[model samples]
Target: MRDPDLTQIDPSRHLLIAGPTASGKSALALAVARAQGGLVVNADALQVWSCWRVLTARPTTADEAMAPHALYGHVAPGRSYSVGDWLREVQELTGRRLIVVGGTGLYLTALTRGLARIPPTPPDLRAAADARLRQEGGLEGMVRDLDDATRARIDLQNPARVQRAWEVLQATGRGIADWQAETPPPLMAPDDCQRVLITTDRDWLADRIAMRFRAMLDWGALDEVRAMLPVWDPQAQWAKAIGAPELVEHLQGRLTLPEATERAIISSRQYAKSQRIWFRGRMKDWHLWRAGNAGVHPLPES
Candidate 1:
């Protein structure tokens, strides 16, 4: 698809660029930033980690030099970061012309739809939930107990989602969905922003995902993962970068380089597929740009 002429949009409106991985989201955001001044904020869940640059496909140093960027690679691997944490950070930046971009659907949902001000789960409760997720027939067992409202609200196939719902239900005696229903006004209501969803054909995105993984290797992803081995905790949020574990497995001699590369590529494709599904479901009102395909057009000026 042809690239959307994103620069033509009203400069005063906040821009939101969301898409699957490897879908030129960063580049488009940079274009919008240069043409229409704004602070380019990071909304990707993984890109916040300081330990990953290549594997997470973070904006290059050169890219950051060209625009004012915020919230990328600022968190240490050990810090506990959540959608709430990200929401608070973004809340502070609402006064500025903002160009928020990422593939993380949860972050965008929290920003535009309003997130529940749910209390933090206690450490003991969190630990117990984590333990149960690992020991008691896995997340599938836990999924069976979530309230019907939360089951309808969250992706049950995701272990992290299921575990979080379980913890909320166990600790608060109320479903996460109940909390979400009571959410206050959003930081950026959809009507106030110019949102763009970049949709790519599956085969095109698959090829790009493979190429980007190889590019990450060429740009020293392995070296980065190697430095992480001494302090790596697979359970940490930072460790969830798409290719980090596969590359770490390779460095640990658990898999050959070729095997790791293939596995990582496959994982990335799967992640992109999930991202596409999520954006499609949640962003029905956003402007749809058929990226990596032909025939893009300019939106009529409002």
Candidate 2:
């Protein structure tokens, strides 16, 4: 498909750029921001944590200096940062055109389709759900017991999502599917924004992921992980970041540097594959730009 004429887009509307890791989505977003004088807002979940900018591949200081950036590394590590928290933060920003870029599908989904109004899961209930999850070996049984529909919809392998559904059920006595039926209006109407999903061949993406991880190591990602180790909580969301856990294992003397590097690359490749599947399924109507294509740039009007 031909690339959309990004230069012709209204500056008042937001731009959403989503794709797999290392897919050049961030570069495309930055190019658009520079051309349109837009604020680059972060939609990537991991990039929101303040403790590990290098590890997360967050925009460098020079990049942020060129254009306004928001919600990148704003949250302290170990804090529970949810999609709703991200939605709230992004919605609070006013004025300026925005180029929202990230690999987090749920955050993008929340922006395009309104989030559910499910009440916060109580702390006690959350603890109970966690305990049950550990005892049950996995969340499949809990989710199946609580809400069959949610079980079908959720990634069964993701303990966090499954636990969240179980917590919602225990707290509100209503399934997550029911709560989703009460979602609010989207923050940005679909017609008001230009959405693009970067596409790359799987083999190319895998190579990029491997190279990026190695580059990250060269750029002090291991040191970044070491600094975060003092505050690392195995249960915390930040600890589960792609490279953090593997590096933690290395730091703890459980794995060699080469072993950690290999594992991290494999994990990243798997994640990118999942993200590609999600973008293809969820963003069918969004413009698809091939990775490395010059067509992504905004051209001067005649």
Candidate 3:
């Protein structure tokens, strides 16, 4: 539904809100948290780093003032946070009602669908992968080296996913897909929660993304980038925030502000497109809400 009936949400069940960036998912989650007295936990990977708030579309202070929020901007600038790490942290938050929300499909998926307990990649292997990424400026080598099954299963366009698969295959002599095939039960099974997937028309979402990025610029995103210029590392996990690279280029005088804004908007739109695809493929059973009078696919209230 365009405006979900938060009153209809069952207080006993957790809410899982998933959608592309700028698709009003956070707004819906906030409404649920307020109406149902649930904690709003972030599932978005990018919003975890302290280095980016405005650029990553993190909840504003006013938003947090409205409801309790956890896991937003809690990570240091150069840390390597993973879905496994996020899952560990999420365990501490489960004593209360929760409205876990974000556009990061991987995190949301792992929350409901068990994540593979793949071993950590050796530091040398990870370093080698990172080095190759910098030298090649793309995931070509890592993707090519992935086992056929992993190559089929992981997101090819996601550098982190590709590198992780490559590392798992190299370090363990088994494909990630093989490891995933042995995953244990999920921490939060889909049947135990109220799952909602927000969908919008493509052009409408693109317009929202562009306007949102421009608004982010107004909200001191450039200044945020300026703060990081002294220690900016393009390969850093936190540096992968969609607009961070473009803004970095802007600060370096490699691009004008307008050019950087355009690039950031383009990147956001592309990322949103990928997110939509991910949810469609992975969250097929989630109640799909197309807004307007189309409404939502009803699920169990409790």
Best by TM-score: 1
Expressed as tens digits, the lDDT of each residue in 255-301 for candidate 3 is 99999999999999999888978887889999877643223322100
TM-score of each: 0.93, 0.92, 0.91
How do the residues 1-302 of candidate 1 rate in per-residue lDDT, one tens digit apiece?
35547544678889888898888788778777877789999999999999888778888887889999999999997878999999899879989999999999999988999889888889899888877887858788888898998988888878998998898898899999998889999889877898888888789778778877887888899999999999988887899999889999999999999999999999989998888788878889988776743233221000
| Candidate 3: residue 16 lDDT (0-100) | 85
Query: By lDDT, highest first, what's the ranking?
Result: 1, 3, 2
lDDT of 3 at 15: 84
Candidate 1 Cα RMSD (Å): 4.2
Residues 72-172, candidate 2, lDDT per residue (tens digit)?
A: 98988746778999888888774567788999998998899899978887778877877788884656677567677777777777788888888888888
Give candidates' CA RMSD values in order: 4.2, 4.3, 4.5
Sorted by TM-score (best first), the order is 1, 2, 3
Off by over 4 Å in 1: 1-4, 292-302
Candidate 3: where is the Cα deviation over 4 Å?
Answer: 1-4, 136-140, 291-302
Better of 1 and 3 by lDDT: 1
Q: How much is 52 displaced in model 1, in angstroms?
A: 0.4
- The list of candidate 2 runs beyond 4 A from truth reads 1-12, 136-138, 294-302
